[model samples]
Target: MRVLLTNDDGIQATGLHAMRRALLERVPGIELAVIAPDSNRSASARSITTRQPLAVDEVRFADGERGFATDGTPVDCVRFAVLGLVGEPPELIVSGINHGSNLGDDVTYSGTVAAAFEGALLGIPAIAVSQQAEHGRTDFRPRGRGWAYEDFAAGARFVAELVAAIDGLPLGERTVLNVNVPAGEVRGVRVCRLGRRIYRDELKLESVAPNGRKHYRIYGAEPGYHEEPGTDFEAVADSMIAVTPLGFDLNHERALAELGRVDLQAAFARSIERQELAHEG
Candidate 1:
């Protein structure tokens, strides 16, 4: 199977390297090509370049594997790879092995998740993987942390197997799998829905600069509210890997129907026509 790997963390990120190694070692007969951002662009969402031209560069690893890096967002990297870089589109698109968790509403702002979303938009099956870590903790040296590379590799292998076996699965138009691995040994995998998290404190504004500028920072507990059972957040908190299916199309159908009850469309059309006539005069 051919796979396209991309991430928001840039080509040099350790998590990206670890995931590439794991895929190569475990998934036999897999052809892999990577196209990623040249620098970290986390939380960039699904932005695409429209004005400036995107730049791509050839990159070589120590092991002689060739990949490409782009001066663009995660979604842009996937778009370029599918439309320009590869001779043929890949069978699967795997994003991240991200440095942190993408749970609940975080996915809405995550470049890691957006990469997979872009692939799904292009009609390819995709997966977004994230490793949950303790906030404010820096060293992810693997150690015997149980959430080490070995454990993550195991989970990755399981996900690969599932993808291979599940035929004709409804990959909703613009659908992608968002997988979050907990910060310790995984109990097992759980199919879940997005959960809610509430932060303890609001961001605080600090002192103003001599040039009359204000600075602000977010400070608070890792303390927060969590969702009830059967949610992605709950699954991770309980030491289980969470697999949440996500989609790109977001429309409030019920809300639209309610607005339509008052002949809103006719009113909108008349208003637009009146404005156009006024402008013409």
Candidate 2:
């Protein structure tokens, strides 16, 4: 199978390389097209480049593997591949082995998950993989000098196995599997729902420039999650891989049914009647 492997982390990121190595070793007869951002685009969400034209460069990895790097967001990488840059549309899209865990409500702000969403939007099966940070480490970046590819080996291996067995999995055409791997030993895998986040971020003014520009910090602290049962956060806390199926449908069916009974048309007519009465007076 042909898989489009991309990530929000740059092409040189250790996590991405670890996944690449795993796919090459574990998945039989798998072809990979690696395309990703030239630099880190973390927390970019589902954003695509519109104003400026994107540039793609052929980059050679330290292991002598060549891949494409673009000056665009993670979504753009998927679009770039589907739009014939990689010869044809890929059969699957695997994003990440990301630097940090994209859990709870925070997945909405993750470029890793956003890439998978784009692939699912295009009728392709997609998976977003993330690894939990070490204990008490809010800084999701590499520790000390840097992280070796082995730091992400466990997550990469699991994803490779999942990809190989995807034919037997019951996945919808427009569904994305959001996977989060624990830092230490793997307990097992759990299918769960998203947990709510309790944000403690405070807005603070850092400094004022001579040009009257103010610098403020809002997301200064790491957010916490509710300890709910059968949640993605809860599963990861117990050192298990959390797999949450995500869809793009944002409609609230219950609210739709309730609002359908309201007299919205009469309310609109009343507003128009009030405007006419005011004009005459």
Candidate 3:
């Protein structure tokens, strides 16, 4: 099977490299194509480059394999492959073994998740995988100085096995399987729903320069999650892998019905009548 692997952590990232090695070694007869950002594009979401043409570079990865690096967002990389830029389109797209967990509302702002969303939109089954850091280790970079592929081996191998059985997985049209592996040993895998995040962002003024430009800090604070059962956050807290099926359809059927009960047409007609009366006056 031909699979396209991409990530928001750039080509040289440990997570990306781990995924490469796992897929090649575990998935038998799997042809892999790597296309990722030249630098970290985390939280870039589904944005695409429209102002200028994207530039692509051919480079050798840590595993001595050639891959493409682009000055584009994660979604752009997916577009390039679907547009026949990476030879024939791939049958599946696997995005990430991300440096950090993409849980709850975080998926909306995640470039890793966005790449999978793009693949699913183009009729290809996709998976977005991430690994949470160990307790007190906020930095999710490679272990020590050298590239520690084994740190991400478990999650990477799981994804490789997932790809082998993807045909049997219940992947709906325009849907993505979002996976998040906990730090340390993975106890088990749980299919759960997206959880809620409790943000504690504070706005602080760092400095005001001579040019009257003020430098402030609004983000970078640690976020908390609601202790809800059967959520992705809860699954990971129990040292389990969380797999949430995300669909492209954003329609809220209950809200639609509630809004339909409102007489919006009557309100428009009343506004028109008022305008006509004022014009006549």
For each of the candidates, give the backbone clash count.
0, 0, 0
Taking the tens digit of each residue's C-alpha lDDT, what string does model 1 give over 217-266? 77444534465888988887887888999987789889988877888788
Q: Pick the candidate with the highest TM-score.
A: 2
Which digits, one per residue and each the tens of the lDDT, describe model 2 over residues 107-224? 8899999999999999999999998877433233434445667768889999999999988899987999999988878889999998888888898999999999999998757677
Candidates 1 and 2, the one with greater lDDT: 2
Residue-level lDDT tens digits of model 3 in 13-106: 8899899999999998898999999999988999999999999999886558899999999999999888888799999999998988888988
lDDT top scorer: 2
**Prediction RMSDs, each to the true structure:** 4.2, 1.8, 2.4
lDDT of 3 at 112: 95
Model 3 per-residue lDDT at 183: 80
Shift of residue 6 alpha carbon in model 3, Å:
0.5
Each model's C-alpha lDDT? 0.79, 0.90, 0.89
**Cα lDDT, model 3, residue 116:** 98
